[model samples]
Target: MAGKRCLKGVDIMKLRFLGACREVGRSALLLDDNVMLDYGIKMGEPPEYPVNGVRPEVVLLSHCHIDHSGLLPNLMDIEPEVFMTPPTADLANLLLKDSLKIAESTGVNAPYDAGDLHTFMYKTKTVDYRIKFQTHGYNVEFYDAGHIPGAACTHVTSKSGESLLYTGDINTSDTRLVSGAVEFPNADYLAIESTYFSKEHIPRKETEETFIESLKSTLDIGGNVIIPAFAIGRTQELLMLLDAYGIRPYVDGMGKEAYEIMMKHPSYLRNPTHLKRAFDNAISVKSSRRDDVPLESSVIVTTSGMLNGGPSMYYLNKLYDDPKSKMMLTGYQVEGTNGRMAMDTGIIENNGVLQQLRLKLEQYDFSAHAGDKELKAIVKDFCDRGTKAVFTMHGDNTEGFATWIEEEIGVQAYAPVIGEKFDLH
Candidate 1:
């Protein structure tokens, strides 16, 4: 959809919700039909993509999570100018290539080929936080999102002085990896994720302690502890946490490469040395060593965080019948994913067969996104700063969050549906 011109000889700032309006995944937002923020794909059986047909002149990517940056290469035909932080660029490259490989191995049709990925990479420009840049008649700045390495909340303004602040994904509390997000930038409109709008996290320290206790108990019982983690942020955070607790786990899957990629961009890390030490202490699992991982009472960190695939599945297949063993899931499991299915039914479909798991299972809140209170604080901060409107999205209960913003924050709030467009004025 294209932006419409007003009769007053002014360009109207139109906002379109192409995806991630009321649910998580495939998060694409079009601003005046020229700028796109976060073109990502939702992971599932066939995988879901954002609504097609808009060729954004500029794409402001917020982070490197697959749900946020998965489909960037699909726009290679337009050769859209893409902007992101340095680490985000590198990590997105890693993930996009990995996504293609996974798709081919699973016989799923990939949306873009290697040629698209190469073209997309060539067009990507890495920008630092707080630096002002212009693209397609819009001024843009990046603010640290604290969600992961190189994750950013974007501030954008048009030549006409109309502006918007889009919180791609944010975390307000410090984690082992990144610091809390920077303060909000005042703008006319605010668009933010509400992933944990109705949920508050257990204090981070307490949650870590509980996780450690469970892990130790599982190991003391003469069983291996398998931790399924996301490759980018969660895996590194878990490694740091485990290092602090004097545990050297066997790390496997793409997380190994992600750790290496992150090391090249040390400025994004809270403590590069600490992460280095953690990685040095942990064992890297190679294909030849995969069979050796489950022989002892050790902690193994692997990926496909949702247990959809990766070495985590291999370990589960090996030890599923062992009641003493435990599989500790360490991230948000999207609905229809193997992790969610296993959590809810104790059965996960793997390799085209359904298998009941006898191993002890548990989920830990190691999310990179903000919690309930933090999310509200983000909304409130923008509202207090005179943001004219707030748009809640990227969660299941966004409508409730929007209602809260109207009732408590006294700002006009909207929960947009896919394909809905609004004149921001």
Candidate 2:
């Protein structure tokens, strides 16, 4: 449904929410019917995607995370002109290729193929942050999102003069790898992520101390530690943290390649020296060397944070029967994932067989998203600048966040459902 004009002679800008409404994955949004923002997918046993058959004239990506930019390869058939930062382009390519390999190994038909990935790369154009450009009669710009390397918050001005901002997986808190997101130009319509709304993150220093202490305790007891992290942002950040705390970990999976890519682009990181130190201190694990990983008094950091695939599973299979060993999950585990199931119950399924885990399991909150206070600050910052409308998304509690924004922040806020459309003027 469209909103009525509150002012005379103002043009209407229609928005359609294709995904990431009250959920935290598959984020797709269409503006003015021609431009699309962030077409991604939800990772699970049976992966889910954004609404199909969207043939936008142009696509603006926010980051490389699967939940924000996973479905871009599928759009090769449409041949949409895609724009992202250079780092994002590199990371997305790495991740999509891995995704295709995983799909093939699992006997699942992927939506796109190697040819599609090549086409997607061919149509991609890299842009730097804060630089405005014209695309299909719209003025477009990107701001640093601070969630991951080259993540961005997108702003667009329609041909008819309406303005909109779409924040994709934002993190307004400084991390070891990246700085916090800062102010952007105000717009009439705002779409922001609410990943951590109603929750506050522990202070970074304290969290680091706790994590280090836990690792030390496990090592002291002659137990090996396994840290499952996302291949992109979280793995790199954890490596820095481990280096800072004087711990050397065995790095495995796509995270190893991801760090190599990150090293090539020092401009995208907060401190290249720290990242370099981490890489220097860590031991890189080759796939053929998996069986040689020391079973005692060692720390292993691997990818597939949700434990759905990757080398994390290989390590877990080897260590699951060791009572003294411990597994530390370093990221959010979506429901129905092996990681989540293991956390809730000491059981994990392998090859269609469920088995009880003897090793200890722990979870730490090392999310890259902004917390409640940060989300509120972002909303109030834009609200004070005369943002007329707000839409909360990319979380389970989107409706609650929208209500809070409307009632507490004193702005017109909405929690749109999937496939919902609105006309903003």
Candidate 3:
């Protein structure tokens, strides 16, 4: 809680990293001991949450992804006012409810219950991008981050005039769903995600074409194509991509509900009309009709993305022994997840029994986060705006990314560890 004095003798702002420092998951940061950003949980055998104990006056979420917003229900006892975009609130509620069901089925105790969810939702206050508001002594604004339907970058200014910007998950390159993140007012302190700092994404068009070709190849051989995608963002993006390529896909799982949610907020999307068309072109899979899905020469899109649980497992189980069938992964497979194991070892455990996969497995880079080159461009833009200090987080190699940022951008950069604190002047 120590602060440094600024040039005008005003106390500088303080930052504490609660989670998502050296690795990607459970992103949380405490600002000035009163306001918090992104209380989340890492997905694994036993989920991991952000450090607890200190209760903030308010919590500001950057997005609704599980890694960024999963643990919000845990804070319901404190009843802190939560702020996020309207879409984020809705999406987060969906994800949290699903998490509770998953935990119940697996015989694990969820940190919070239905009552907590109700309380969390009751205290939530939705805000649109660029609208300035007051929370405690800080002036806060949200900026579109272009990572998902309602993802945002949070910018805050202390009463003393010091400013800090937290770039939640960001994508600087435009996708079929939304435009890339736009430039915003610069700040003295910047916290950026480095999820793909050391990697470069393939050209978007090239990746799309390749994926479509693979899908067509599988279907041509009378093999079913199973695409396991995240329910929210990736699912919609894949639907649009398939539609644009003139392919009809069967949509299943929570993605169908998520799509309906997105349709409600047309302003947050790049092309609402196009999305609508994509939705119309895709066949929505109904639970009653799931048994009727064509077993061959068809494409199916389902969720849980990681193969942990969901309709994807049902589809995978049916296609496991079909050598001609293809399983396409459309997002990052975090370490220790069922998806990663399937990708790396071609083995999946079901009902405590190990099953070998004989289907063709492939992964495509349809990630929503920006890649290394795009991230560098973002850093360069902020540096040009006189950002003095940068804190890197939400990646596997934050330390490496921080070093590169400091040496290449000529600005002080650090990859903080969990529970570390810093005084910004």
Error of 3 at 279 (Å): 1.4
Cα error, candidate 3, residue 7 (Å): 14
lDDT of all predictions, in order shown? 0.89, 0.89, 0.90
Q: Hey, what RMSD does candidate 2 come out at?
A: 1.9
Kindly report which residue stretches of model 1 are placed more than 4 angstroms away from their true locations once superposed: 1-11
Q: Compose the digit string of candidate 2's lDDT tens values, residues 1-425.
A: 33323322267888888899898899999987879899899887788888876789999999999988888888888788899999999999999999999889888999899999999889999999999998999999999999998999999999888899999988888999999898688898899998899999998888889989988998999999999999999999999999988899999999988888988888889998999889889999999999998888999999889998788888888889998989999898987789989999999987677878999898998989999999999999999998888999999899999999989989989888888888765
**Tens digit of lDDT per residue, candidate 3, span 1-425?**
22332322245788889999898899999998878999999887667888888788899999998999888888889888889999999999999998899889988899889999999899999999989999887899999999999999999998778898999999988999989898678898899999999999999999999999989999998999999999999999999999988999999999888888888888999998999999899999997788899888989999989888888888888889999999999999988889989989999876666779999999999999999998889988998998888899999999998899889888888888888888775
Q: What is the lDDT of residue 72 in candidate 1?
A: 84
Each prediction's total of clashing residue pairs, residues at least 3 apart in sequence or on different chains, is 0, 0, 0
Worst 10 residues of 3 by lDDT: 1-10
